[model samples]
Target: MARPSYLARRAGGRYFLQIRLGKRAAELFQLPLLRVSLRTSDFAEARRRLVDNLGWVLELIEAPDLEAIGTVFDVRLRAYVDRGSPADERLLAERCAFENEVRRYFTRAQERGYAYQKRFPEIPGRWVDFVDQNKAAESSITRLTARRSYEAGRREAREAFNEGWEPAPNKAPALRPETLDPIAMLDRLVQDAVGRRMAQLAPGNLAPVAAPTIVPAETGNPNEPAKSDGSTATTPDRMSILLQEFLRPAGRKRQHTMKGRGEAEAVVQFAIDFLGDPRIDELTEEKWKLLDDALPDIPNRDNIPREFSQTLFQRFKYAETHGWKDLVRVTTTTIQSRYWGGLYKFLDFVIEQKLYAGPRPKFVCIDPENLAPLPRDAFDDTELLQLLQQPLFTGCKNRLHVWQPGGYFVQSHIYWGFLICILTGMRPGEVGQLKCADIRTDGEFYYFDLRPFDARSGRVALKDLRNLKTNAAGRVIPIHPILIELGLLDRMQDLIDKKEERLFPEWEAYIRKDGTVRWSQPLSKSWQYVKKLLKLSRADLTLYSTRHLMADWLDNEAIAQRTRDRILGHANDVRGRYGRKGILDPEIAAKIEALEPAVIKQMRKMLLSAKNRADAGGLTVLKTY
Candidate 1:
């Protein structure tokens, strides 16, 4: 019934322990009032907790140095930095494990009714706060138990008096005296533990430790400190480190494509080589402009102006003399989109991590005049015929062999894979990553199941999984009669017999450093060989041109725009969105089959020629299509 002391109930119906700080401590710690929640609804319990809370406040005030009160949070942060040190790998790993344990322990304590944020209002909630709150709660509970017993005893005595009987002497329970300040006791425990850890982690140095130096890019010069505003700045986060962190699974929900990652790495490497591998904070607008200026000189494989081409050829010759090989050229769009986009993304991460103090830079835009014209994507019928007649597509001992023809039919998968792409509007990757199981039969129709699967059976890595470019890419495409006649089902059966999960097991998966598997690498290489042998002059007639060719074919056949888009894994329109996505309708399948007769006749001619050669060599003849 008495007015609460410094412990008062707020509008939330919970009690708070309010204490006004002195001028010196307030300025040092940057707070005026230390208003911590007692974390109780009962007034009596609040009063009891207030005693312990006030003790901690007094201890803080009396301390010689505010920084001396190092918490487990500081220790954990220090340990994280140490773990990145090349010199103390073993010790740092141990410290990291210990830090994790401490974090988990405090998390459990929080779950067990310990109020962290409420108790330490000024300081960020950490393991040390959890420990203190837990200890204080235990002490309060003990006092509560004693207080309840004493009250019960007083009630019994009142009952005895009402019954007109004299109460027994010394029978009443006595409330225990407050022997120790709970907060002070916990503070001692936390400080002692933290002090021991700090000494172990960094012997003799009681001062706060700085964060560890981030691992720089491959081309990064570690000795060079980041320059900021014409002055040497503190070692900023490395660009490579920033990019790696940006690509981490937790950083973003969507995974980056291999091409995207390659572009990012290329830009980062260029930036480091050109700009001396400075910290992310050092990636100023001026530095970016330098990169932009250099982009034009970086020779691109794509078409360029005659002057630029001559300059590139001369540079190539000069580089050949110096033994430097495979120099990549960046286009204006590559600079504006891939390079600038990568830098922009990295900058975003820097800003998000609060490492960059500079204002956000605008995205690099290419001038309409500076942008190079893109080449045609679709291959002409003559080019497509040339592609079909290649040695790899006909029959070969090894698909990789430039000219050897007299061997077992080892290139059937590669041959059919390309043929399938030309007939159906499928991506190269989609065909390359197809498993035996993906060649499914539904009733009278057979189709390729271009859908993702759980590839976590240790047989294949995540990167090896059939990753689609987009949601619409996961579709069922009915097998064209040309593919079926080319023994596509028989090929799947052969793979199944060999216990191979992938239909194109011969086309080995190339797992990238980042754990992304690229099944299309071998296929891409073969296509390059095919293009070179056939003397294809059009840069746009790359392996992806198969899909473009199909687009052209379907368009020529006067197929619906939605149907064409659906077949080629393009985004669907409003009407197309109404039905089940990625599932081919029976009517649509019939229409897809309509374009197969011409393709079948062409494949039949090529197979017949290969069969005749095999028969002449006394080799087993391939089945007639």
Candidate 2:
């Protein structure tokens, strides 16, 4: 029984390692398809290597004796050899292909029960190895085929092949092209596209694509958006506050956000270095100078926009107006410099994020200490009567004639927005974002629903309203007469009747050129105009001051601490849901409305008649420590 083995054979004609097998090779016969001339290689090493190695091969194959033995001894080997075949490449290859052909021939031989084993040969090695290895292997088939002299005729074919030889060509070269500039080619393509598409549109082709125009790339397509190509572009004008502010969208992947941060920081760092604060001033000086110095040379891309800077300044002025001046007073040696520095950084952040423009804010704070030097005869009682005679604001366009009758358009409407702010104490953002639908007048109360607003660019660019400044900032405040007189009730009713969502329009203006709009002006202009007309100047008073005024007004009148806090968007200790929206209960409206108009009107009349109440001898708290 031959052992299992590795087998290889020629498909055409050749002698090759056919089956490597051993003494225990009977497993070959188990395979029904395996039928062969079970003969050995004429080469001695072929028998020893292949046959001797079958033990190792048997460990791998799961088949039992018959399949293994038949495959190794007969299905693979072809042992017919014409006497004197030489070993050569032509001989080896032809035989390699031929041996397998001969192996296949044996399947026919077995069925015929022929006394002969035949070989159709291509090269010499097959017949030679059959003679040599078989003699050494003494395989069972060799013993059988020997008595049959008819097989020797089949082995003579290989002797004809090695006698004729030829060589194959190995090397050849083809012509090729010279230059390849992939980037330059892409650039040219983009340029061609831009030139072709950028001509004036035919008609009705007016929609801003999500994409901004593509500028030619420095190397290729300038219009392509910035890629993380380790590149930089510089510009002289630094007005794009958002570019400077360089804020990335919140909650982006670290890799993406880091890239945005890098771009933002590049622009912002330039601005900061330009400010040169630390270098110009001594350490003792407000030391705003220290920021430029201390900031690491490398920073994430965070734009420090001008708008944010202006807001910080505005915030400071607001604080000063509200008796928080202790936070803003800047001085060379003021230990409070830290707060100012923070203010600067915060403003820088705001600018980069497009919160404000780059220019520092210029809004002034009113002095609580001085209100004197009034222009005499500015308005007599007779004038006051006429000013009062004008019925309070009605829902009129008034855009054409807001200054009608006495050019006191601002004065006429001052009481509208101003009084409400004083009564409600909502910040400007809250007030500006207001809408008519938000005001609620039900059974026995007035509720101002503070919702989202976006007056930037008059909502032409985009609608930018949101629910509240913060969850805590959202509140419903009970209204007083001022709210009613200001047309809030009518507006709310109009909205409800019409089923509209908006509460107010933060006013703006537009210009039409040739019956087509081209430009717009901020509507806050109208607000300012209204303030000027009233001649009622107060410290830190703006739309926001109303919220302050309301809080202080309530406080001065001895309103409960919990209630005052609730009115000012602060949490009320008496209630778990602190701040403005918590004050939404109808009960709060009843309480706010309960304030005597007589007291309010009296305070107003008295304050207006004089500059400093010291002349009227308003009491001052004397400190005698």
| CA lDDT, every model vs. true structure | 0.61, 0.41
Tell me the tens digit of each residue's lDDT in model 2 across 1-625.
Answer: 3433444444443223334334343333322233222233434444444443344234423335323323333323343354324232223333333344434334434445432322322222343455454334334434545745555644454554567733467678775547888998899999988876765354665555453444442233342244334233332233233333344443433322222243234324433333422211122322334333322221111233333333333333244344432333322222123333334444455555454444643212223332233222222333334334332221122434534432222222233443455456665545545566566554567677553431110112212444354444645677776556534565566655766555543232243321222111233454466558776464343434345445555765677776666566664444636233223555555666777544467544543432133234442211111
477-571, model 1: which lDDT tens digit per residue?
77887677656777778768878787776666787655565667766887777677767777666888878888887887888887787788887
The most accurate candidate by lDDT is 1
User: Which regions of candidate 1 are displaced past 4 Å?
Assistant: 1-259, 282-297, 301-329, 365-373, 393-402, 453-465, 573-575, 597-600, 608-618, 621-625
Give the TM-scores of the predictions, in the order they appear: 0.53, 0.35
lDDT of 1 at 401: 59
TM-score of 2: 0.35
Q: What number of backbone clashes does candidate 2 have, counting pairs of residues 3 or more apart or in separate chains?
A: 95
Clashes of 1: 3
In angstroms, what RMSD does candidate 1 have relative to the true structure? 25.5
Q: Residue pairs in steric clash, candidate 1?
A: 299-329, 300-329, 463-517
Superposed by TM-score, candidate 2 places the C-alpha of residue 14 at a distance from the truth, in angstroms, of 64
